[model samples]
Target: MDLSFLSEQVLWGISVGQLIVAAVLPLLGFLAQSVVRRLLRRVMSRLRKEGDLSVVDDVNRLLTRPLSFLINVALWNGVIGLLDLPEEPLSIHSWATTLGMVALILVIAYCAFHVVDVFAGIATRAAEKTETKLDDQLVAPVTNTVKLLVALIMVAAILGQFGYSATGLIASLSIGGLAVAFAAKDTLANIFGSIVIFSERPFQIGDIVEISGVEGAVEEVGIRSTRIRQFDQTVSILPNQTFTNVEVRNLSKRESRRVRFEVTLTHEATVAQLEDFLDSIRHSLAQRTDLHPDQSMVRLTKLDTNGLGVLVQAFTISTDFAEFMVTQEEILLRVRRLAEEQELPIMPAKEVRLSGEVGEPRSS
Candidate 1:
């Protein structure tokens, strides 16, 4: 088995036996890491199904690399010690130690990213329990901020490892950052705009808002931009700065959706028939729980060559677009039925169009 050559020195007075052990250590570490990950995945899967511990699943997935890196570093450090690397000439031992330290620092930073996710998970759960919705808007931006801070710190640590003064580096960055700020003034403004949104809170997440000539439910409020998921299923990422100065109409904040439509009947339709239709509509609207009882208005406001303009205005309790559309559908269908009951021709089927906002019509 060549056991006699096991004691022979390979380099730096290290025996072949020690070199073989050092090489085998990494292989063992790899096997151990794989076994540990498999066990963790199984355990996390159980925990995820049995309880509300979804965070464990995330930790298992995200921490694999950092954990594996840790094991590799530890094994290599042991290898370095076992080899008794020389201190003089190249300072290979010192260089290796320093490199390992930098690597450990990076791994720590990497782990810090998931640490933020853990806290964010906790915050999100807590937000769900709270009655106030403003807390929900903070989770994304704060999580992003902590991650950015972690990266910046990691860069500083790496700089210091190269014998650069951390304080001096920051001072230099402060000066350089000012120039960068000037150069990327728009970015800074957007960041500040985000701050304004957080502080002022003109509209919170999930609010159906019309802002900056765009209409949608606010999907996310990020550091530099606001994401609006439009009605057409497209997402518009507008600069945060765009919201700071523009008019923001929070449509969802309203108590009820304002619905206004003109139902035109034939010019030959009499005042008595129109009045009867209006009275019937008002009575029918009062019976519905979705509409505000006192607010329903059905008036014959116009008599022209075109037709008799029967203006129908009411406020629906629904704030959501789809729900409001359903309400509109029911009301329009009802109006048509009433016109048919009176044997009045509608000229053709009437159409409802969105002009200004949900249930709000544009001026003629």
Candidate 2:
């Protein structure tokens, strides 16, 4: 087989043409991007001059991502077209090409939408009067959910472009949903629970709370679980559903804690002395304006064989554990000093017995 059919002049011309096109395409690509960038700047400057910074900022950010993507895409297409593709015996399907183009367009639209969403999130947070990390918490889920929906729609559209049926896929998913539901029951419960928790706000991150005998400060409230940093320096992970179903005690909710305790006094105390002691305690407590005025209550409740049980109630202004402990100690110390000055002794239990109860007399 003598292959002298291909002439050198034709091959040389094709190579020269490819080289020239490659060198010129880059210059053209740069000019196009430069023109687009100038147009965007002019538009943004006009918006800013009109005192609509919000719109200007949005447009500025929106143009940047897509413009960069567009410029890169142009460069790529220019390079690809410049190459002298081989003339070989091959077949190409028009339908497949059309489907590919549609998918490409869909992907580009999705990316543009994603850029807009990011800018919107930033603008929303900046415009708010008050700041909260909850905004940060919500943005991820909202953005992801939107992206997922958009992607699903784009996929369906692309599939339809290829003559695939959306209804058939939906039916297949429905058929498989039962088993999937069974496998993901906990996840579903947690998702639903997160909704409830966010709406109700039983507890938030950084709040000291107690639930199911576990006491700790909430570290994070996630979509599926809540993490708490325990007092013992370990972390506890509880399912979000548990908080929805079980009782949660939020210590941060209460500004103060009411403390209850009982102290026994000697049964031998005279009524006058007891009255004096009670009056002293009341007076001492009344002097403490830091404590809730309505919270001070002391009473003689019961008389026991050992002593008189005196019930005492007081309030601490702060729910902080350390503060509560300090206030409690001070109150007890004051009570002790006052009792000592009044000579009221702490009651002590006693036992007495009689000699010669029943005995036969012996002859001496």
Full-model lDDT for every candidate = 0.84, 0.75
Q: For model 1, where is the 10-residue window of minimal lDDT?
A: 52-61
Cα lDDT for residue 210, model 2?
Answer: 94
Q: Identify the leading candidate in terms of lDDT.
A: 1
Candidate 1: residue 204 lDDT (0-100): 82
Candidate 1: where are CA atoms >4 Å away? 1-87, 92-97, 124-141, 166-176, 196-206, 263-277, 287-289, 300-310, 320-323, 326-364
* Candidate 1 lDDT tens digits, 1-364: 5698989998867799889998899999989899978987887887788785667756764677778878888887788878877777888888887787788788888788877887888898898887656678778778988999999899888888878888997787897878887989998889999898888888888888998779998888888898999999889999988877889899878998988999888877777887888988888888889988788888888887777788999999877777889999899899889988987777666588667887676799
Clashing pairs in 2: none
lDDT of 2: 0.75
TM-score of each: 0.62, 0.72
lDDT of each residue in 1-364, candidate 2, tens digit only: 7534333234424465566666787788788788888999899989989997867767876776577666656565555545534444331234435544574656477575757586656746663543334444555665666677777877887788778899898787985878888989999899888788777777766788999988999887778888889999899998988877788999878879877787789877889988899889889888986689877998988787868877779888888888888888888898889889999997665667545455855455
